[model samples]
Target: MYPKILICDDVVYSRTMLKNILDQIGQYIIVEVENGKELISELLKSRETGAEFSYLFLDLELRREDGISLLREVRKMEPLLKIFLSGGISLTDENIKKGIDLGVKGFVSKPYKSKHVKTIFKSV
Candidate 1:
């Protein structure tokens, strides 16, 4: 089966851009969520159905939820999941370190670029 790639971003434009970039790389089932609650719900549903996403690109500044908190919960449930973070704000070294501490595989700064997308895919 084609691998599923999950994208959790609050911005519609960002999600579309990411989906388009990933589509250029390979065939993948790209799942999208606009908030933390949907992110959790989708992950749980996927796990139960044996359709867990192969990669997750999460926005650092999700609406109404702390990304770090959400990441912690996701790590608890899916320790092996490959996760990456993205944000409009420039990623500080501290923020990157925090994500790394939480088991993030990589980070992609917005707006999405072919090179950044390619790098994350390769790293994962």
Candidate 2:
């Protein structure tokens, strides 16, 4: 199935940033959220509507809550969804361990490269 991507970041610019990259993918339907709260809410709503979430680009830090908290909840509710974490969380062993436990697909940075986004979309 063609994946529907969700971008969740507290920073307005960061959300716009990935939205631009995901738009270039042509096939995947991209959705945007401002924080973990909105992300979880949308996930729940989408679940009710039978719209599957395929990819999620989540920022680790948020004013209201952390994406890891949302990640944990997503695993419980939507285990099949693939997640990508960016900004405020390093790709460290501990973080990778946590993300892998929930089946994260990949990651991008705050200042993501266009070429890398192109490559990743092609590969996925």
Candidate 3:
């Protein structure tokens, strides 16, 4: 079965680009969200239907909210979920340390890299 991916990024262009690559891979169910707020809301709503996403692809900087907060909240709610951080924003060593501290599965710097993403999802 294909792995499911929930992609949360504020930028339309970025989301579209990521979608194209993931679609080509044909091994992932990519669900796109505009930001952390929307992602969290969808997650809560999905509980009624008992649906869950397998992988999370999140942007660091977002419109009106930050992905880190969502990450933190999700960790608190579902600690075992896999997460892949992606965006133009670069986390400092300190920030990376903090993310590692949070137990995030992976960190990906964007403008989307198809090969890297494919390699990554394959390994998982």
**Predicted candidate 3 versus true structure: per-residue lDDT over 7-82, tens digit per residue:** 8888999889888988887867678899766888867765666677787887878878766777798788667778
Off by over 4 Å in 3: none
**Candidate 1, superposed: residue stretches over 4 Å from native:** none
TM-score of each: 0.95, 0.85, 0.87
Winner on TM-score (1 vs 2): 1
Residue 57 shift from truth in candidate 3, angstroms: 0.3
lDDT of 3 at 73: 87
lDDT of 1 by residue, 1-124 (tens): 9999999999999999999999999999999999988988999999999988888999988878888888888889889999998986737788899899988988888999989889888876
Measured by TM-score, how close is model 3 to the native structure?
A: 0.87
Give all candidates' CA lDDT scores.
Answer: 0.89, 0.76, 0.77
Residue 101 in candidate 3 has what lDDT? 87
User: Pairs clashing in candidate 3?
Assistant: none
- The per-prediction tally of clashing pairs is 0, 0, 0
- Relative to the unseen true structure, what is the Cα RMSD of model 2? 2.1
TM-score of candidate 2 to 2 decimals: 0.85
Best by lDDT: 1
